[model samples]
Target: MAIHRSDSGRAPDTRELAKLARSARQGDTEAFLELIESLKGALYRTARTILRNDEDCADALQDTIVGAYQAIRSLREPAHVQTWLYRILINACNTILQKRQRQSLPGTLPEPAADSPVYQDVELREAIDRLEEPLRLVVVLVYLEDMRIADAAAILGISEGAAKMRLKRSKAQLRSWLAPADMGRERSS
Candidate 1:
């Protein structure tokens, strides 16, 4: 399937989503699997960016897929499936964060696999992890995932202005976090 760019001018096409939603709502297992296949990478990346741990990210993605499948019938607008799935993923991440916060183990969490390319640049990843959850979510969805600001706002349950504001702040924070000597290398080069 060809991927059409989103409004942000980077994301892929969401046009086929309506058919996937219809089949999923009808309890078509193959269709549901197709839906998952289309979204799983983005969902996992979003979760990983937010949670910063492989186990938590995997758990969040799993929960999101299950929740999406179960809740497909309640979705009124089939064309908005991408946003709907993102919302579920964000919710699942938030739930996991809240649980981690309550357990007081947030900071102690370890990074994911060293072999993964995502871990290649430790300083950048560390900088991203230091951001507040809200800003981090916005950065991941918009910059990394290439989602449009309006669609991200919808998925994040925030106003468009709020999404833009968050994106600005996230960029500023990333800049600030990278200001230290070693960390500054990435941006300068």
Candidate 2:
């Protein structure tokens, strides 16, 4: 059975997830360790989005593990584990941000996701970095990670309407920043 089944796969194996979540809750360290693999990429992407530094993303990931471990027992369902994990990750990122703010460091571009050509563009990454925190986060969760808007809103602890509003605003901002020449091309076409 696939670990992180995507939207189009046959129904996910709930029994496998239940066993994993149960083991993790029962102090099985290895099961807990294995469960993290499904989330590592998305976690890295979101952390990178928020911190824009590889080291900071690593720190945030570490914090996320610790926080998730401490709180996993409270989680009520295995099916929503990824969403629950994302909420923990966002908290960890916020903690790292607080530390960075106190130290007064300039943000830098993180290594982009290796799987996507779109992430390869330095200018696009720079444009994303210029967005406000809420808008940037919405873009990362929705556009970059291909998560549902509802999932993004849940992970961000916001209403769905609020998430939609941020996405709408961010789209306008990104259009202005990344595609100035497209306007002329559109008219000509």
Candidate 3:
């Protein structure tokens, strides 16, 4: 059930997605619900990586879902529904982060037990949380969501070079955060 990068390098069926988007845009509630169900896990994971709080992530996702419903009509390219949803998710997470900042909330928080593996995976999750937002988003989109660099760049509304730069930084940060002690534990099992 791990959501890691796909090695096969095949693109998803954009035609079918476009049809769904068109239907949803035309006020088809079931189509919209189906779209949400298809993307919920990835959306939640992306929000969790950015917001780093279960409650905030959930709130952000809820906001994103609502926003998407309202904004779907404005979407020019139905074929790009996935990227469109990702853009909304990022915006939602950013909004939550800004609100939390105004309230002086901590930036990074631990994942819930249900969302993480046992004690052995705690260090790995901590390493991921240690990343800055830019790097973390790239990691989540590229690795966790199995998006290619070009596609991830499109989703994040950044240049491919920027995406690559962020990925490089994220990997380096993760390696540094893992270090010897953390790596030992992760590798021992």
**Model 2 TM-score, all chains together:** 0.79
Name model 3 segments beyond 4 Å from true: 1-13, 105-120, 179-189
Candidate 3 C-alpha lDDT tens digits along 115-168: 542114777776776777788788878886678899899988899999999999
Q: What is the C-alpha lDDT profile of model 1 across 6-121, one tens digit per residue?
A: 45444445667688778778888777788778677788878877787788988999899889888888989888989999888888998998898888764575554333344447
Alpha carbon lDDT at 126, candidate 1:
69
Q: For each candidate, how many residue pairs have backbone atoms clashing (under 3 Å)?
A: 1, 0, 0
- TM-scores of the candidates are 0.79, 0.79, 0.79
Q: Rate the local accuracy (lDDT) of all candidates.
A: 0.79, 0.79, 0.77
Instruction: Report lDDT (Cα) of residue 7, candidate 3.
Output: 45
Candidate 2 residue spans exceeding 4 A from truth: 1-19, 105-118, 185-189
- Superposition TM-score, candidate 3 onto the true structure: 0.79
- Show where candidate 1 strays beyond 4 Å: 1-12, 105-122, 179-189
Clashes of 3: 0
